[model samples]
Target: MNLKSAWSRRSFLSSLGVASGSLLTSATAKAEGMFGKKPKAETKRLVDGNPIVPITSGLGSTGDIYAELGVKPLINIVGTVTVIGGSVMKPEVMELIRRGNEHFVLIDELEVAAGKFIARLCKSPAGYTGLVTGGAAAAMVVGYAAMMTEDLEERIKLCPDVATFPRNEVIIQKAHRYAFDHQIRQTGAKLVEVVTREEMIAAINPKTVAIHFTNIQSDRGQVSGPETVAIAKAHGIYTFNDASADVPPVSRLWEYPAVGFDMVTFSGGKDIQGPQASGILIGKEELIHWALLNMSPQEDRIGRCCKVGKETIFGLLKALEIFVNQDYDETLRMYDARAKLISDAIAKFGVTARPREFNPNALGNVTPRYSWQIDPTKLKITGQDVMQGLADTKPVGIGSFGAGAGGMRGRDPEAEARMKAHPELAQQRRRGNGPGRDPNTFGFAVWQLKDGEDQIIADRLVEIFSAAPKA
Candidate 1:
């Protein structure tokens, strides 16, 4: 009866020959390109470009809980990972950013002033420099430039052009290859990916600008602090130890560089609670100096693009002072408590949930992950469903994907039962298609959860579970 149905008859078919056919095709096929065009591929950043998810006011500016037949969603128990723009700035950091915004000084002078302090904190020898960049990855690129060739002459020149100086190849292990390796290329340095101790050692040539050690322990090529620094030293190559999000178990604050790695990087926003756009690039003074020289406010410098607002730099320093001295053990205990909350929630669902303590020597950080074993006969969801469901939520959400080895959706016998038993109740489920109770997906993350939000979660879950049809 409508246009589509009307098109099936002979008259409609006859009309589809010439001019009419073109119009029909245009309407039928979306004017060739006029239909529902899918959105562009999404990046790590969120829709608004600013990456904070409002905890109190959600996507719709509604309260955390929807009427949900009378239920609120659960508080996040997950740590502040990317899906959530790292972590919130500590109050002290926020205040500093606010104050710094009020005035302007020579960015170069600011760099000079901050560098002195950063060098002292890292215990690097003089000429130790300070540079502010968007984050650790930015630091890697800028730092690479400094170690390669400093000053105007070589700063702009890249490898193959400078035969006399180090050609600047960054060595990374096969197993230790990281997502940020691409950052090194930004500086015109080539990345030589190697696997095994032999390949790593042999891979280093005179052209090598620096040897990069990704923070991890399990990979055979994963080096200890002493070994990594030692190898780079023998080759006269600068050593870069990248400990991206590996904070917590505070000893690491002084560990990597202390072991002699020439340079180190840390995220300011993670455990440090500094500004989200901030991070710490600590190590040899001279290299840092050169690195600092390459960033914004320095015209035509190879490191010119990455800019760290003066406020973010200052806030990072303050956050570091607090982070390095705070009661680290207390922080770990809080994480433990959060993990326990997730486990406790899962227990009611009849799933055996346990906290997996991460090894510091391995990944170089100490955070806990919640691993769950659900019996599938009772649950109908799949991990993919859960991830998609969470993403589809009004406010949208994110969490770890494919955590454990076994797939709960496919093999678990009581997965459905486990979903039903969850304390927060999966029955009425925040009232959308619940993540298909996927086995690979654990219930949810404890990362995003802050102080005092468990009850809303409990009530919401109960509502979801309560609404389900009786088996």
Candidate 2:
């Protein structure tokens, strides 16, 4: 049936308080309990000072909300990507979000208070502070806007239209250019591409406001972070580093700022396990002030649309606190144990699961990976087939099987045609340590998986191998 018809049917059934199979049953139960008889005072007591607790009584827990909506939740084998809901928030962070929702405060005042807390935790430089944004991309929009406008009320409102602005150019390395540059371009500043140190030095003109650095691709470019910072300082231009996914060593939160980048941004959602829509922007006090003026709690500005709720801000701070103070070595050991559980389960099927260590100082998601080598003589299925099998599991599909291609660099017909014409280009693209590229091997990281999820994956893998056709 059509979507409209289906929605109408669901709505009609919901109004009558009738359970239409499993789809509407959970939602109906929730609605009825909202106006139902109040619970006993003893039963309503906060657990461990937490105001919210899981409902375990009447309708026997409202059931899985995803199941009710017919949307299957997946076991995240992917480290931390937005497509799979990033990371789950910590219990403390969730408590803070709940607490934050209980009252209303001036957004500006709350943001300033939160910024001071972030600055202290991150060990930001003497004159630097922090600002919570919608996300890393939102941080970019405001960061750039801050440099271009600089607390000028007139320029803030007329931003993304910097015709009259004295400085409107952002210098970036040619190799560092990527998809997120679109956020920088949103401020109406021209991105000046530089390939070499000499070119970068030459590009610094009166119109240049800042130098953009892509933290993950630092080695791919001619200039390093220190070099970029030095050059920006010499020319009296600001520097902004987009280090969104470069956490988990956890020191990068303050390291980038200490390295002298005028501004640095990290994704609060990814490894930090904060609200999915939040980000942390740490930078000089003046620039942060400009950024705040250009964003929400202040309308008629470019970043007015990038509004970060109070709950999200509080959640981000709490998550950051937990992340910085976390025992990383213990976390790593836990991940290893989880991988071993899956490895031991499928070993009898001639699948050798070996641990792959991750470099702690790596520029991107730092997590240990596990690769399973399928024995072709034992099972007719290839590693890609096994990946598909896991993804096809019922109730909750398992994901992050493949190498995760085609996510950001979406379908480009022209690029595809070029790769097709040149076999070497295609070969180059396939060269990676990730799984699903080879017929015999498939792998994924277990750090993103929640408690007991590894067992579910282990059982699923056994089922796939056992049901496969004999070679």
Candidate 3:
């Protein structure tokens, strides 16, 4: 549209009342102004006197990828676990990765640059440094190799096959033994499990390389962090704490190591919201240096297969930057709001849903938790039925019943027998959600619900209850 043609159309529209008289007049003035016959209206500015423009938008959607693959993405009410692909990374983290894709840098050089930033972010002590690895498990391999040797050449060569090495034992509290202990053992180190501090002290023979602790299991173990670190320090052994899933009061990243542990590993993907495949291992500078020697980029080392790409490192770095400084109180309030929404939604139907405080053992989804006491008589549906319905729905919503309600009960001999036959049963038990232990009580996490997802969940629940009970 030329200005004259535009004005003629506007004038015709104005005569037919399709355009307002003022609009026609404004169009005529714009036409005259374009020809320099009239003064143009001053261009408007935003409050800050800057030109208003739409901010940049649109990265391609993963939904398309999943759709093309004939797979549906599940709603993550179960929290950030490896099976569910961990929590989604922050926009800042993604942006860092987006920009990272545009360039190429030597892996070793990039690690050095990224390491400094991560060290500062994790508040690593002046003598300590940090390295982003392939998730918390990979950190185990790196940390194990680091503690295995101070000699760079020996460190790289001895890993992935430490049969000839003298100090090949990594002491761990029997209670702290977890699925990821395999990551540590992968470096040809044997895990020596001890129950008591006395046992741990006694177990730390000349062959002991380091002591490992699982942060979530810390509360259960008799040996406190300080005690473990003290024993390790006294014995001249390195201590590595697997503080993987325990985050959200993100201060724990540096706090654990600051308390005297030689190394601490945290999942970059979980609460820290980095790349799902990356993690942070921050501790003593010397140990981190040795670990870097044993990591990827040096294809001959034990952790060579634990390759963390340039994008993942940068993503973890950015996530750490935002995580530490983020307004956690505001986040908690949002979580609280989501929890309340679900609790409130179910309350009207005689179901008792309450927002529960976050328990450290809840792992990845550590925001406010919501548990429901559904009276089967009132709703005419069992908690198990509700769980199954939600699970069967398109874009499945997974939730847990009362803690330990789902999964193999330790006390049940049959459950134990079943666990041995199906090793995955053990994983499901640890996941905190399996078969409901109670028919009347069930719960779900709220923090993992994306915007407007709570409504979908609530509607789904209402729909399930609305249908008549099966005879």
RMSD of each: 19.3, 10.1, 11.5
User: Which ten-residue region of model 3 has the weakest summed lDDT?
Assistant: 44-53
> What TM-score does each of the candidates earn?
0.67, 0.83, 0.77
Instruction: Report lDDT (CA) for all predictions.
Output: 0.62, 0.86, 0.76
- Model 3: per-residue Cα lDDT over 299-366, one tens digit each: 77788888989888888888888889999888878877877777777777777864475765354345
lDDT of each residue in 289-379, candidate 2, tens digit only = 9999999979999999999999999999999999999999999899899989999999999999755768888888887788888989888
Compared with the true structure, model 1 gives a TM-score of 0.67
lDDT-wise, the better of 1 and 2 is 2
Off by over 4 Å in 1: 1-78, 120-130, 157-166, 196-204, 222-225, 339-365, 371-444, 469-471
For model 1, the run of ten residues with the poorest summed lDDT: 42-51
Query: What's the ranking of the predictions by lDDT, best on top?
Result: 2, 3, 1
Q: By the lDDT metric, which is better: model 2 or model 3?
A: 2
Off by over 4 Å in 3: 1-63, 360-365, 395-437, 468-471
**Cand. 2 Cα-lDDT:** 0.86
Better of 1 and 3 by TM-score: 3
